[model samples]
Target: MRQLPKLSFWQIWNISFGFLGVQFGFALQNANASRILSNLGADLHHLPLFWLAAPIMGLIVQPIVGHVSDRTWNRLGRRLPYILGGALVSMLAMFMMPNASMVVAWMAPVLFGAIIFALMDGSFNVTFQPFRALVADMLPDEQRNVGYSIQSFLINAGAVIGSILPYVLTNMMGVSNEAPDGQVPQSVIWSFYIGGAILIISVLVTVFKTKEYPPAEFNEYKNISEAEQQEKQSFWVTLRSMPKTMVQLAVVQFFAWFALYLMWVYTTPAVAQHFWHTPVGDAGSAQYNEAGNWVGIIFGAYSLFAALFSIAMPWLAKQWGRKTVYALALLAGCLGFVSMYFLTNPNHLIVSMIGIGIAWAAILSMPFAILSSALPAKKMGIYMGIFNFTIAGPQIISGLLGGTILKTFFDGQAIYILIVAGVSMLLGAIAVYFVDDIHAKSH
Candidate 1:
């Protein structure tokens, strides 16, 4: 039997706290960047391309990080080194992103911003892969669910604060909301600085305070035969021969992420154009900041519901099984997306988001758990990295297609993009029914 050292609840909390900071960066990006692009004179049709850097970077970085980290086991620990390094780089990107329009012209600003954002986004994933593995390393399988749940809670908690920061700063701090056309507001700039600082500090807290299990413990369950581990195939060969299950999950992931990309890309515009009844780029417009605040409220509703639903999921899983629970969540999300077509009032958006949030929680936790159970312990890092390719790859595909859909089918009506996305998610939910969860358990 492999003996694992016990981690107390607080110790687990301390180790995972950095994710709160990371989510702060992600929340700000997801909730507001498209709106910021519009403020900075980006064409509505071109906005999806501006978000492309993140997915492209993720595709390249995650695998390399996993490959390298698998071969490393240093004194400060293999994962912690990447965690600290990535956080510092991401902090720099966070500080520079809001200032991009200040320095350059037209798409130049966004081009430069995307470059930095891509770097930071990729680095963050580097740290993220190993960190989850670290939990599996330190905790017994029974405690695994609790460890991941804490991480999920922190992710949502951080999102709430990050989502609300722009509203808080604009309303309470008297920060200047106005900027030269094609520039981010002063309040948003300050939010990035604060977020960057928190990013570094939160990760550092974990690095200084938490100790990793040694290599012996990490490899105790990793005693596969050398012949089994030997590679007759190259990277391209393995890539070509990717497991059928992985390919199936990728299809499901593609639709799931595409829908989410649509939501993140167009929520503000959907609110501003459809619900708030306002045109873009009008300052004294009641819809301008109101749209921004409602974005926060909508995001807060989804994230808060995600947090709540994550807690309820274990119970649901017990009663109906994970696939059934996931199917119900996706069905709810489809209904929520369909409802957006009818949403005239801003308050109703929150109700729609509650449905989406249930799906979001399942998206974050369940797929990975299912995938992790199937992968070999030695290749967990690589397989997880490959799993992330599904995420980034779909986002890239969505970025390309979402823009086209918004421009052509929707007639620049971003809400219809969500309708398409909702249908996509429904397809993803249906695909989950075919996955072999029985094999996952036997493994």
Candidate 2:
């Protein structure tokens, strides 16, 4: 195999920068969607149902985007076209989401909000899966960890900004965190707007600055056989031929994403009820809004710690094996999530966030790094797209059963859902031990 040249740190950073925008948008969605929906009249039990929009979008969108982008080469380059297109759509979605009430006067704001949520996440999925393939396409095997680590850093950095923006606007700039009946607060409205603008600008930097190898050069560098390069197989057919590592990774992904789904769909309610002493289904209350803002700060802490951890993770992985580091990071997150069940002080949550942040870093980078070495050169994009099922699948299952489980087992307490999340993450940590990393020791 012709070795791909090592990229400078800045070169890798620039290539991964577009993800900063995607994760920024994602952070906004994760931190605020429950709040926004509740403000618009949805029950807490239905929040997970609403969140099904994102993963469903990812499940359908990523593989198609991936399959098409694998064959898509143009002036903008293979992944750039999708990256740019998705960003533009995402910008529009961000603008539309918080303003879902105003758009369709005849429809319920909650329903419109769900639709917009789908669009926002669908657009993110468009950019996200390709970004994964892009790293595998560009970086040599030895540099793959760096590429993904840098990508993880950018992702968490963007998340930190996005998650905190509403709180910043409310507290620092004196924007109103309250709104009229059935309307989202001004701080949230403004965060989406700013996030949209930054999304497009950051994506433009990547589209304009980074270049992709043309098809001919990429094939030569990866040493793909001509017949394999030209070969077309149905996704299901290719699924049967999947690498053992990908299958193993999927098992771990299921639990990791299941845990994350609980956090995203329930954290606002859990924190509001537990720390802020808000009533169930309390929307548009001062206490609830305060809880929402604090959740933003807390989620920002999660991403900030994730960003900080990303810098240290590669070194840790190199010292221990990647799988070992991944397991330990998830263990930290399990402790963090389980602790949330017992903590009532808002500020003390930051201590718990540190562990989740470390796990988030490993979750973002380690699996992809492990999988990249096992994937076929000719099908990086499609396989990366398919790997997303591991992400979206568990979340889908969680969303479907989440409400029922909560009511049945936990007396509908959101805090107890976090305990379930902890258990799931613990399972993921254990599953990490079984993954067959092709470069298990080296990375």
Candidate 3:
């Protein structure tokens, strides 16, 4: 195969375009899944159980997909095929999730949607890790910051649109807000359908338009021979002997993701109870859906900041160093989470999201940038997959424990969840100082 020229700005934009759709799907789901579950008659205490699909899928699918992508070299290239396949699955799952309450009597439809959600989420992560690695493989170091920033922008932008879709459908389209005691609102159903179509189209753009680097170039890890590919240590062996960096990163990731999971899960409830002063089943009231939409608006604000900060981070790292910049970002998130406790008006919530958004941008980009430099190139996919365990594992822990805290300590109120999340973010910031980024400028 002939050597392809480096991608232009537009090329990078096109390749990264799918995430816009992916985030749209994910943002809508993440911001509202718990709300949807509650509307379907799930207890507040059991909400965490229903939200378990994401971390579970990430834990199981990422490494396997990473390993497969490492060895894959086909007509569609290494990562695009996985991307395409995942997009299709996620779209179908998105469509099903909103309609889950339609299940017949005696069968838990929410549970059914949760299962399909697991499948979709798992498939998406399988494709996601490889896609991140592909960026590392394709871009030179200088351009990586730009590449990732564009991605962050798309992620937040997509989420903003997704989160607001339900509000648009319900308020503007005259959708039914009430659905007896066991069904979902028509607005949410419309959001999922719209999200599904957008998801498929965005992913297909990359599948059809972008070309990938040849496999031989990707496999030249430490200048080692691919001839002894089998002679090299097996994945199980590598799994047994993980690098120290991955181990430490995992420790930090546990706390970081835990905090984030809490924020996403509880933001709506916290806003509804604390800010809006409303309950889930309040009729003829827009408070719940309005609070939900405000969460989207708040999330979008953070994402807007995150996209801007993603650009500044690389430069900031060049000056004060990665550790310091990351530390500051975490501190900002901590402050943001803490501020939620003091928020009286709904509009004031935007102030908190700005800090969380800074942390969000860094968490998404800096960790990958740090890991890519330290990991073995030939095993990039597998290690990246393994690296994802840090992200997924904490989420699982949070899913289990966050519920316990909410029920036992706070009487199922969501404010306490944000408090725990704030502490977790602060703890994660402390851990960042210890991470050794080789490419990061010396202080």
Candidate 4:
């Protein structure tokens, strides 16, 4: 079998640059979606259900995009076509999401926001799944760690900007942070608009600057026998034949994503209530909007730390082993979540983000690095798509439970939700210990 050629640093950068755009759009959604939903008149109890659009659409879109991208070969290359198409759709969705209330006065604002959220998420999955596969495809085993780390770095880099955009706009550029009831802030609206433009432009750079190996070259490099090449693996067949490592890693992914889902869904309300003393129904209050923008800055802190930590994760993985590093990182994240309950000063939450950022960097790079080694080269895209199930499934389950948990158990206290997230992350840390790191084993 001929090994894949090692790509130069710039080549790797070019291929992974699109992640900046993808994450730029995604981070905006993550940091702002809850605020938007609340602004559109969503109640605190039902917020999780409304935020369901992202993970639900991801559940449906990622695997299909992966399967199709695996078989596709066009002038735009296998993954690039999907990347470009998804970027355009995502750009439109980002632009429209913040404006959902404005477009249809008669439509329920929550419903409109949900539809737009799904569109943004589905488009993101289309680009995201293939991009993961592309890294595995283009890089040899020795370099896959670095490739994934670079992707993580760019992902968090974009996230930093995306997360901070609204805060920066309002604070520095003097954009209005407050709007009338049922409308999102002008700062957030402009942030989305700028984010959309950057998303498309960054993706186009990757589409033009990076080239994919043709099918014949790819088959030859992986040493696929003609018969094996010709045999099409049904989705069920692939599902049944998944590597044991992938199955084990899925367990780790589940709790990790579940914890993250809670944070994303409740952070805005939690911060508003905890720091700003805004009541549950005060979405239109100036204090509430200010709290939301502060959440953006807090998220930016984590993203910035994640980007910096990504630079060190690969080396740490090499020294301590992937599973060890991952588990420890998750443990830190668990503590980070727990720290939230004690934080009286909102800005002090940046300390909590340091631990969370370490985990974020590890989460973005480690599983993919390990899983890529165990996957069949020909089936990389599909398996990566299926791997997303672990991510989306946990999120879906968490969203379903979030409202019930808030109403029944917490007395509508969002701070308690952070404690639950901390415990969930602790479970994830334990789960990671069970994953067999094929890369570490092989080395």
Overlapping backbone residue pairs in candidate 4 total 0
In model 2, the runs with Cα more than 4 Å from the true position are none
Candidate 3 or 1, higher TM-score: 3
Worst 10-residue lDDT window for candidate 3 reads 279-288
**CA lDDT of every candidate:** 0.75, 0.92, 0.78, 0.91
lDDT of 2 by residue, 1-443 (tens): 67788888888888989899889999999999999999888988888899999899999999999899989889989998999999999999999999888965699888999989999999999989888999999899999888999999999999999999999999999999999878999999999999999999999998887989998888889998788877889989987998999999999999999999999999988898888877777777899999999999999999999999999887888888899999999999999999987776889999999989999999999999999999988888999999999999999999999999888887777899999999999999999988988787666
**Tens-digit lDDT track of model 3 for 1-443:** 23224568888787788888888898888877877777666677777777777998898898888888877889999888888888888898888887877774656876776776687677668657766877776766656666776777777778778877776667778876555555667777888889989988998887787787766665452354656465567778988876776776776687789999998888888888888888633422467767776776787778777877876876787788777877889889999999999888888888988899999988887777777777766787889888888998889888898778887888767877898898999999999878877766532
Give the distance in Å from residue 425's predicted Cα in candidate 3 to where it truly belongs. 0.5
- Name the lDDT value of residue 2 in candidate 1: 65
User: What does candidate 4's lDDT look like per residue over 138-202, in tens digits?
Assistant: 99998988999999999999999999999999889999998888888899999999999999999
In candidate 3, list every pair of residues with a backbone clash: none
In model 1, where do residues sit more than 4 Å from their true spots?
3-6, 105-107, 225-233, 240-244, 280-286, 439-443
Instruction: Please name the candidate that would achieve the greatest lDDT relative to the true structure.
Output: 2
The superposed Cα distance between candidate 4 and the true structure at residue 242, in angstroms, equals: 0.5
TM-score, cand. 3: 0.93
Question: What TM-score does structure 2 among the candidates reach?
Answer: 0.99
Ranking by lDDT: 2, 4, 3, 1
| Model 1, CA-based lDDT | 0.75
